[model samples]
Target: MSTEPTASGHEAASPAVDPPAWLQRIKSNYCRVCGSPLKLLKPDGEREWRHVCGSCGYVDYHNPKLVVGCIVEHEGKILLCRRAIEPCRGLWTLPAGFMELNESTAAGAARETWEEANAAVKVLAPYAHWDIPVIGQAYILFRAALAPPYTFSSGSESLEVALFAPESIPFDQLAFSSVSITLRLYLEDLRAGTFRLHHGVIDKRPGSQPNDPGAFVVRDHMALELGGASATAAGPGVQEQ
Candidate 1:
């Protein structure tokens, strides 16, 4: 199919038929310690194959990344950012980013909100943990609220920033499945007057390529629809959020 830019000034969403190279965790092809070519080998007593340097016996285990984000609320509206970057530019998403060194996950979430939405939020609690094995990313989200005056604007990574009422959420335009899952459950809880920790997995459909339709299967734990982790599961040390 032909492609065109959307009203948001980003390219139309296209099927990721070809495996999205950006999603895959890069495995080392060579050993950094000995500068030797590495081979994928299963160690005698291990359950997984890793890049091993035959010369020095050094091994590199490729690990998934930790992504931190928040569900920020102001009044009865939820905050969202329209991404101005790749992977899913023009798509709407909650403010989030990769966890950085020396920062608690909750702190990371707060930083991301400030960086992407220019809003200071007080993170309240752990919300959900979802593992996207297909993309080698584990998302940890928190519940948060606008700090003080609750002012916000678009950050460098976003084209636009706005608060969305539950019924006005652009579900079809969300950048990631994790965002969809979190928002869906958040809305359900909003109506039900109860909230709890949620755990889920985003699995790749068997025999499907990245760009194939229905390539990923999202599991939702609650009555309606939708959906990994580590780092301060929140409290006093989370003072920054």
Candidate 2:
């Protein structure tokens, strides 16, 4: 969906909308394991419909993919790539892509940076993670620095690659929601001279169409969200210890 570049902070409203392209469902006709036509079934004790094979009993799971990326800082600038492919072609974004098999998240992040930016990086730590339920993707980004003899060029998937200072970042022309959120938060931390893990959700705005980029809401920390409890809370299974 078409939208103006969102500002630097949390949006006011976040309404869950139907996922584009039916992301929550598997559209493939054949099972990956046995090449048999798949059937949608809940299976015994399963809650969600899964594509399962009656012949091989192979269950096709539609798990959310991990899109790993890096916020590589060199000479106080962050690396970005200009896409040469569709789905936001010609837009600038962090060096990221889908994680590959048999690799750790950090390794995948590093690999993506190299593949798209032609830059070798040393990952420092986990920096941010954002869940986009609308597209069934969870972004795992990292803090990194350019490795020895820092140099870069555009890869096959990128039309160009470059570094941008915080003030010079192309906020309005970022390719994806995840990239914008990562860069904005990174810049905030840079100004504060402190770094910490960030987590958030990107959900559809109320009344938004399928083509809209949706809205972002800060979720703070997952442990804080799931662990905090009320002192006076009472429920069907409540018992004071």
lDDT of each: 0.76, 0.73
The TM-score of candidate 1 is: 0.76
Per-residue lDDT for 1-241 in model 2, tens only? Answer: 2234455332322223433235334576788888998876667975445678988999987889999998888877778898998778888988888999999999999999999989999887677888877577889997778887799999999999998878999988888777877777677656655565677776655444322355544453331121222211011111224
RMSD of each: 11.8, 12.1
TM-scores for all candidates: the values are 0.76, 0.77
- Clashing residue pairs in candidate 2, if any? 1-211, 1-212
Deviation of model 1 at 52, angstroms: 0.9
Give Cα distance to truth, residue 152, candidate 2, Å.
Answer: 0.5
Off by over 4 Å in 2: 1-25, 205-241
Candidate 1, residues 1-241: lDDT per residue as tens digits? 2335575444333233432343224557778998988876567876445678989999886779999998887777889999999878899999999999999999999999999999999988778898887667899998888897789999999999999888999987888778887888777766655565777787766445433445666664433222112222122122233
